[model samples]
Target chain A: MTSTETTPFREAPIQPGDLLLSIENLHACVEENEILRGVSLQIRAGEIHALMGRNGSGKSTLSKVVAGHPAYTVTAGSIHYRGQDLLGLAPEDRARSGVFLGFQYPVEIPGVSNLEFLRVSCNARRQHRGQEELDTFAFEDHVRETMAIVQMDPAFLERSVNEGFSGGEKKRNEVLQMALLEPLVAILDETDSGLDIDALRIVANGVKKLALPTTATLLITHYQRLLDAITPDFVHVMAAGRILRTGDKDLAMALEQRGYDWIEEADGSDTLQP
Target chain B: MSNVTQSRPRLWLETLLQVLAQWSGGGAAGQPAGARDWGLPTRRSEAWRFTDLRCLTQLDPTRLHTGTAAPHWPEAFRQAPSGQVSPRRLSLQLDGRGHWLSPQGEPPPWPHGLMPLPTGDIAPGQVLRTVIPSGTLLPLGAQLNGVTPGPSLGLQVSGPDPVHLDLAIQAEHAQAWLAPHVLLVLQPGARLCLNWHVAATAQAAVLPMVEARLGLGAQLEEATMAWGCPGAAFLGGSFIHQSPRSVYRRTNATWGWGLSRDEPFVRQSQGQAETHLHGLAVARGQSLLDTHSTVYFDGPAGRLRQRHQALADDRGHSVFNGRVVVPRVAQQTDASQLSRNLLLSTKARIDTKPQLEIVADDVQCTHGATVSCLQADELFYLQSRGIGRDQASRLLQRGFCEEILQRLPQSALLWPSLQSLLETPVPDQP
Candidate 1:
């Protein structure tokens, strides 16, 4: 009944064969502008991975590429989701295969009820897994249960999807969706951007409660404050579209103390024809 | 000119002409003096631009027949009048094969401002008169079946008591033309609610003309719903005249049809008159639907508000032309018009025009028209929730029609029929 040993700063390296997601030298561009240049990272199951980077460091583009967004084209490199090649799948197919992206800016849809939409999305995943579709009552029960986990009001389900929703409410709704979908690999792409301190804690706690032994999470954020709430097993510093340095939780503390300029300086000396 | 002569006149046109000729030979019992001057469709007319008259000329004049037997009316229409709250009074049911009228009530007094339908070579001046006594609430209902090439009903109503007229018309294979000369003369403080339904089958064609005149201080609430089959064609015209201090509200809802057109003309002749017109038209497959409405402010201190919405899918097309005119005499006239269209398919098209002509210096008039496709974000949102793209589109389209459908009087009963027409796969029919 004893809890596992807690690491205050440093943690051991992830053993081989524990990888849940592997992005190999990924190169992606949006339209004519190249955003991601040879980025690579590995996320292990039962562990939280923190991706910290400055603005315009291709953090968002890499998440979009992994989610199979239509706007970002992957010219090279490969993404493996649970050892399955993710590049050949459509965005929706990728979602059906247990890949979830909590969008930074969720789209607003008027005249479409939130309950009706969630039921359909849940059923799609079930259908993809060869399971029977849940009837109305079962679907409503599932939504209510998930709404509780995210601390969202039940009335939000009756309103149009994300229509006229406040910033915190939309972020909470995205987490609620993640809870309901229960994806094996979830990528939170700047979801903490507009959330207040209280909303940020609720969202982080929701993710922490939903994480399973076989589930892996990639928390992409600009600030290390989110990592403080949901401490990651591995922390990676990304600059200029590549992983400049990888360490345990202490690297995040170091970066928080010195800012991204120190990481750029360290990477600059390492790659200077040595 | 050569094309006009070579093209056959419309079958309805030929039937009208033959009926007019027969009535003229019978010494014009109900004919007006200026009948000959009423113009017929020609190549030069703006209304006849998209309609081809050549196929109509091929119809033989000898095919026209007259009989005392009435066409069979559907059971749905026969049972509709029983639901009316008012007492049964003068009622005319034209089943196409024969005519029936309840003999319990006396004729209503004719209103002073009654205007007859303009007669041409095809249509003779004829009027069906029904009179209900003052201080009595009368419920009138009629069912017209247009299965044959020549069948029509002309009805006029006048009385001081409040009246409710429920008219339902169904046309089958052959073409039919109905000119209902409704001249309702409401006394001071009188009120009326008129409900009319016109539906045509795939092979039928129908033309319904409804005209009403309101007295001073009167109020009228009118609602009309028209639907046509894949190959059917429909032409509907409604003319309303408002007296001093009278108020009128009219709503028209249409869906389905091969080709359907509705023209509503409203004129306010005295001060403090108010009128409102709202309509919705939905077309699927290769069907074509159009609405033309005009509101005229000929009196001072008049007000008019009009709004029209259209949704076109598949290869369907919709056209809307709304005009609000304020004359120099209409010193304090206020008018507004808006037309909004949603095109679902790449091939679906909509043409909307909102025109405002104001000659009065102290009048306010405004008009706007917009055509757009379904929002991509909205579609994605629905898809993200679990509904397929097709089902999401249908739901959104139905929401678009809900505004105008709310205005229909019998939407409770008519909604199912309209939904079926919308959901049913478009049949390949010519």
Candidate 2:
């Protein structure tokens, strides 16, 4: 099996300043079971794009396929990031190239401290970019600065990587990593899931402060409440592995009021596109 | 008939005879029928199913011994009592080879109600025997020095009072075999803390046997760490018997050596007895480390818990076997065993097995084993923060060893020694 996929389609010449990621005709599956069929979306640099969908609507599968998750097979797709063929790179290579995926449920790695974990990840990226390695002092300083953005206590730095963190704390830790890595394209998978109001605000604010003109973010969520805190430049409604509608922030409110039932009837079809 | 009798015997049968002779003191003493009848293990034996002894039996046992004299107490250990900084010590040495105790010194009296081990079967060739008086609370410290090998030492302590014992053994650049036997008896309400640190040269080997008996209401805490030479071999065995209302805690750690193995056996003989065992092993290069522990509940209302963790790198190999057995009479017994391993290189290998044999219907017994590589996400997280992959792995390993290290007593002298082991190029001192 080849490690990467290549698409022949090219977007209209990039407007000197435009979105960082554009996906077209994306079809993905696992073991021949199609999950995401013909999904298309766009996100401009410095913009947060919220993707809303119900359970079993292929929200997570789309993100996984985009991140090059080994389990998902991309049947047909074209993913261009910064004028590069994203589907042609390994997951780690994608990460080194500034693509990051914040897992919905962070994995727990026992016996590996948060500090050490972050240091190694940062060093990998630095090495990939052919930059000088940061010494202990410089690395510690970096950790301190990034952790501040998330309002995380410095003491947690020594603890094992998410070994026993509470739900909200785990979400905040994910953001902490994203802040430290400074990814060009970050797919935040359910970042607001399992958070108390206080924790939600802290995490949302961290994301807001970290966003820059050179970076873009894909915010996947089930509820619109998170959008109230971190407004998205554009909102997309996904149903059954495909984008049903795309519009400004008003689309999220309309969906919240109409409850996806309207989209089901408007399509006039019970079966989803595959 | 003479010619036929002189013909070479079957290799398998000869091996059995050799093992029997060794156990029976070369046949000077009549071999016990039961011991002889046990016979060598075949594929049928459950315990030996995964391990092959054929290759081990082929090696010449005599060649395994290092004949060098033990070295003198390193300047560091000599001044350890004064808290002076010293280089690490070896686990095996030649000079202080035989069983010899330091000059007798006045020791404090032990608390009341402690029972000491009664003098019993002295091994035929025991070289030295030291006895601690009953109810004596003594702080016993000893440093075994030199490169010469072939010394056997034994100790028996009996009392109702609490006792603290500190021991260090060092060996450098010499081949030798040292065996030490320790026996402890704690009367009702007695307590003890025992610490052992061993360091060996590239050609040293150490074998130690420790046995303890805890009386009703007695408690014992023991910790041991071994850092051996590139070619050193260490073999250790511990057996503990607990009575009602007794508690026992044991923790052991080891850095890579040529070859090292630890075996601990615990038996709870009465109700309301508890035992806890925690161990860590870190191996690098071509070193091999193995640990096996068994907990048996022969009485009702007993509880046992054990945790074993290992890290292997650079073609290293680690093996762990843990078993918990509860008999029919041992009702209300609760037991658990967990073994986790981290492999740093694709060539590193770990074999872990956790087994449970329970006959009681109302008992709770659980066992688990896991072997995995470092998490990719975790590693990336550290690398992104400027720590190289190698340093990141080392940090993670140190964290893995920390849980067991926290249980050790406060000794500034020991921390540096442990730290050096965690880093590359294992230090020479203990």
Candidate 3:
């Protein structure tokens, strides 16, 4: 097959107010156990959504199911990306079509140069956008410029990919990837989990900078500190593998003031529904 | 019945002994007398238990003799434009036989500071006797080499400038068994970086025995690529003795042989020296690759560091036995040995044993071995970045081997085998 025929490139740039992603009744499972059960969400271009839930509430599973993680099987669901069937594509195809998943725990790949990985990944995305692939010299300059967004040190470029990086550094690297890939739908899964206050601010600012009018962001977090920084347009409260409540930024503040138990107590009917 | 069966040499071993006995007649004048009878060790021996030598019996005894010079250079070495030599390095070719072939398929003049040692210095059983006492059994590979001693290249490396030398040992024909020997003596304060490439095709076998002695404050760096074709075998090793204040570093990678075994021995004669040994083994198909290395610290204040890695696929087997001995007299010794292996197929096997014997109360020693498959998370992380699964696997495999390959000399990049070794296709499951 020809390159263009197999590659799932973006036909047109996303515009503000466009429905970039639509996950309807997404029922997914890791092996035999279902994690995301009948969960529904929509992400529009130019908007930010925060998925807040207690542990085991299937927030990360929904993100992974949308990003096409191999371990998760979409048992019964349909995901449409840019109005195209996203479930039939491979993980790489999903990634090339402008879907990015910032992993909670970024894997450490020893002996693989971090710069080379970034360059290859960047070129793959550039090719998807019908842009010229950058050579070694050009990519070095380009990556060096992008590294500034996360305040990344040039020395990290020379080491193995996240081999010895601290938790904060790994999160920054995830953000750096996000800045390079220029995804239309970015799923930042717990990007603020292990970060210090300073790192959290840097990561949040990087995400905020990348959240263009033509792109959308889905911030998956447990606390309201990250929401305070990014100011999500919609806040989601998940319980028993479904979104029980989704309101504007005020919902996150109320949850922060009163812990997650308040959400269960306030919406006991929805929380108790199997 | 079992005792008798174990005592009896196999048919191939008997044939090899007879062939070596015949070839030993026309070899160097002062060849060792009893070496002709030194047969290879059987599987009954503890060291040879994991090694299977049934592949040797398939060779024709008549074709085992060496010294048939290739009509032309191997295709891989012919790429260099004729008559133009790189100033940064020097290259020499050994034609499976004992003779060194110049780049143009003729005998070449020795470069400065890298001349052959005088014939008077060669003892009858020098390599064998140095590592093992008389009447003591040598390892199978070393034993095969010691039996049929042939023309040897013994050089004394001495000069102010560091020497960068490339040696290509190529065996081109079928059933051609090469038993080439090399001896190197580095003078005090001298430095030498030698890269050796050993290639044999068809059913050919190469038994290379290299011995080196490092003087005080001297440094020697050796990088070797022992790449063989299927139906071929490599049974070779190096024996090194290091003096005080000296440094020796070796990185050896072997792959593609039906059976390849290396038993290199290093002795810190007076201690206070530094040793770094890094090795990588790539085993696929039905190949078997093994490395048994021993490092001894004889005096006080010595240091040693070693890392060995192997990748096995198909029905291939990879074995590593690293031994570090620090006795009572060798006080203040510091040493570490780590073996990492990646097994890719259900049938593939990897056996690693890091034996550290330290009796010195004040010394520090550490050793570890880990066998694993590719990390699913690492692969998934790459795939999530738009890289295909196959490409991601290749990247991870390259990363696994690069730790040792990057430590090789810069000149090693010129060899085409190094590229092919890295680009080896990932194995498919049955």
| B1-430: candidate 2 lDDT, tens digit per residue | 2434532323443443444345335651343333333334444655444433333233344344433333344344345432222222112222343443321211212223322233554441121122122242211110111111233333344454555555555655454545555666666777776667767765666666566777788888888877875677777766677888899999888885777767777778765799999998888897778786778787898988888999888988888889788889999998888898888899988989887888999988888888888766655444333344455556667767766666666641353467556675211110
Residue-wise C-alpha lDDT for candidate 1, range A1-274, written one tens digit per residue: 1111211222223343477788999998889988888987877778778888898888878887887665788888999977778887656666665778888888776545677667767766666555566777999998998898879999999887788899989989989888877777889888888989999999889989987777888888878888889888877777888878778788789888889888787784442110
- What is the TM-score of each candidate's chain B when compared with the real chain B? 0.74, 0.73, 0.90
For model 2, the superposed segments whose C-alpha errors exceed 4 Å read: A1-18, A126-134, A264-274, B1-45, B53-96, B99-175, B186-205, B215-218, B226-233, B253-261, B280-291, B309-321, B339-362, B369-430
Tens-place lDDT digits, model 1, residues B205-307: 4556555566787888888777777766666766667788888888888877787777777778665799989988887887788787777777899988888
lDDT for position B372 in model 1 = 86
lDDT of 3 by residue, A101-205 (tens): 999999999888898788878877787777778888999999999999999998999989999999999999999999998899999999999999999999999
| lDDT (10s digit) by residue, model 3, range B1-430 | 2334643345456556667776766433333565545566667877778998766666787677574344333454465543124433456776544676666766655556677787787653464466554565677777777667567677888875787767777777788888777788888987888878888766888887778888898899988988887798998788888899999999999989999998888889889999999999999899999999999898999999999999998999999999899999999999999999999999999999988888889998999999999998898798788766777788898899988888887667666777667865332110
Model 1's number of clashes is: 23
- Per-residue error for A134 in candidate 3, Å, reads 4.1
**Per-residue lDDT for A1-274 in model 2, tens only?**
2222212232233342475777889999889799998988777777778888788889888887777776788888799877788888766566666778888888776656677667656655665565555766899998998888889998888887887899998898989888877777789999999999999999999998877766788899988889999888878778888888776677789888988888766752432221
Residue A9, model 3: Cα distance from true site in angstroms? 4.8
The TM-score leader among the candidates is 3
Task: Choose 1 or 2, whichever is better by TM-score.
Answer: 2
How would you class the docking of model 3?
Answer: acceptable
Please identify which of the two predictions, 1 or 3, would achieve the higher lDDT against the true structure: 3
> Between prediction 2 and prediction 3, which has the larger DockQ?
3
